[model samples]
Target: MKLAVLATGNIANKVTQTLVQIKELECYAVASRELSKAQQFKERFGFKKAYGSYEEMVCDPEVELVYITSPHSHHFEHMKLCIEHGKNVICEKAFTVNAAQAREIKSLAQEHKVFVTEAIWTRYMPSRSIINKVLSDGLIGDVKAITANLCYNVCHRNRVSNPTLAGGALLDVGVYCINFALMHLGSDIREIHSTWQKIDTGVDGMNTISIQYNDGRLANLTSAITAKSDRQGIVYGTKGYMVITNINNPSLIRVFDYDDKLIKSVEVPPQISGYEYEFIESVKAIGEGRIESWSMPLTDSIEVMTIMDQIRAQWGLRYPME
Candidate 1:
């Protein structure tokens, strides 16, 4: 599979490092608005070709897959461009600023017969099934509530504070918490209550979200760009509770008995930066002529975006693009 990355940012760098290790994917091309940066990225990551602009890269007939790592605000635009070119796309989390954009992309993808899915890597990782198995096997019987938090001290970065970029904790770290809840708790949400603290740029610096499921289950989530957190996802069940270390990238899942004694622990399988799974899945889906990845289906992506949209609506946090 030939792969092209659509950005030359920090995430692009990290993902490219992992891309080099995937034998199934060719480091085909990389694109940036600036030709020099693209050239640098191409040489650094050993991409076969470099494009001065995204349009140029997507225009390449050999580019089988495009991994979009742009900012949240630009995702809809970039995805539209790629879909129009009939390119399979795996976009970063917070698939778009809102569900409307996500829906439009979904429609365009179907119309173009192109594969499109969110690169919320957690969904594709082995740990997700590990956690699911624990719950399914009744190790944590009758799941009742979940508490997940993902926070980082990144407010100083322009991408975290710029309203024009759709910058905020909710779209970034908070999306993980939301996905963490939905992946485990299911998305039959009865009600959603959320509050946020805004940064100087009028974007959410931190936010807390509570979701009530129709099954009488609850999910409490928190995300912030101004602080660091333990990043744990805890599931409370009738028989026992499970502790997931790092909801962002779960490393270990510990199951505890009613007495708070650790009964079992499962460590996630090793990986090459935890991103290869999404790419591998994307490639497989595209090869199978599928329009979505099973790990993070298009409908799931839209639902996650819808939930985020509702939360932002609650906070009255409208971005410039919106």
Candidate 2:
């Protein structure tokens, strides 16, 4: 599969580093607003071609898949651009600013009959299935609640503090916590209670959310851009509990009994950069003539975006683009 990246940002750099290690994918093209940046990325990663503009790269008929590494604010525009050009897209997390934009992108992708999926890497990791198997096998009998926290001291970065860029802790880090809960608990949410503290830029600097499920289960989640957190996801159950090392990219899963006796510890499988799974899945899906990935389907993407939209509504937070 020929792969093209649409940005020369930090994420693009990291993912490209892993792409060169994947034999199934070609580091075909990279585009940036500035040609020099794209050229540098091309030289650094050995990409076949570099484009000065996104439009120019997407215009290339040989580009099979375009990985979008733009900010949360530009996801809709970038995805739409790819889909309109009859190209398959794998966009970075937060899919869109809101559910409305997500739905619109979905409609456009369907109209174009192209493959499109969100690049939420956790959903596609092998550890996801391992965690699910543990829960399914009654290792955590009758799951009752979940607690996940993912935080980073990144407010100094413009993209993490700028409202116009749809920058905030929620979209950048909170989305992972939300996905962690939904991935394990299932999305039968009954009520959502949330609170947030804003930074000087009027974006959410820190936020806490409590989700009530229809089955009487609860998810207590927290995310912040101003401070650092342990980045753990704990699932409590009647028989025992499991502690996930890192919710962002789960490194290990440890199961225990009610007596706090450690039952088992499972380490995540080895990988290039823990990001190769999304690209691998996208390639498989496109080869199978599928429009969405089974790992992170469009419906799951929209549900997550909707939940964030509700949370923002509670705090009366709206991005400039929204």
lDDT, residue 1, model 2: 94
Q: What TM-score against the true fold does each predicted structure earn?
A: 0.99, 0.99
Give one digit per residue, the lDDT tens place, for model 2 in 1-322: 9999999999999888888988879999999999999999999999999999999999999999999999999999999999999999999988999999999988998999999999999999999889989999998799999999999999999987899999899999999999999998889999999999899999999999999999999999999999999999999999999999988888999999999999989999888889999999999999999999999889999999999999999999999887
Q: Quick one: best lDDT, which candidate? A: 2
Model 2, position 53, has a per-residue lDDT of: 99
Off by over 4 Å in 2: none
Model 1 residue runs over 4 Å out of place are: none
Residues 213-249 of candidate 1: C-alpha lDDT, one tens digit per residue: 9999999999999999999999999998999999988
Whole-model lDDT per candidate: 0.93, 0.94
* TM-score quality measure for candidate 1: 0.99
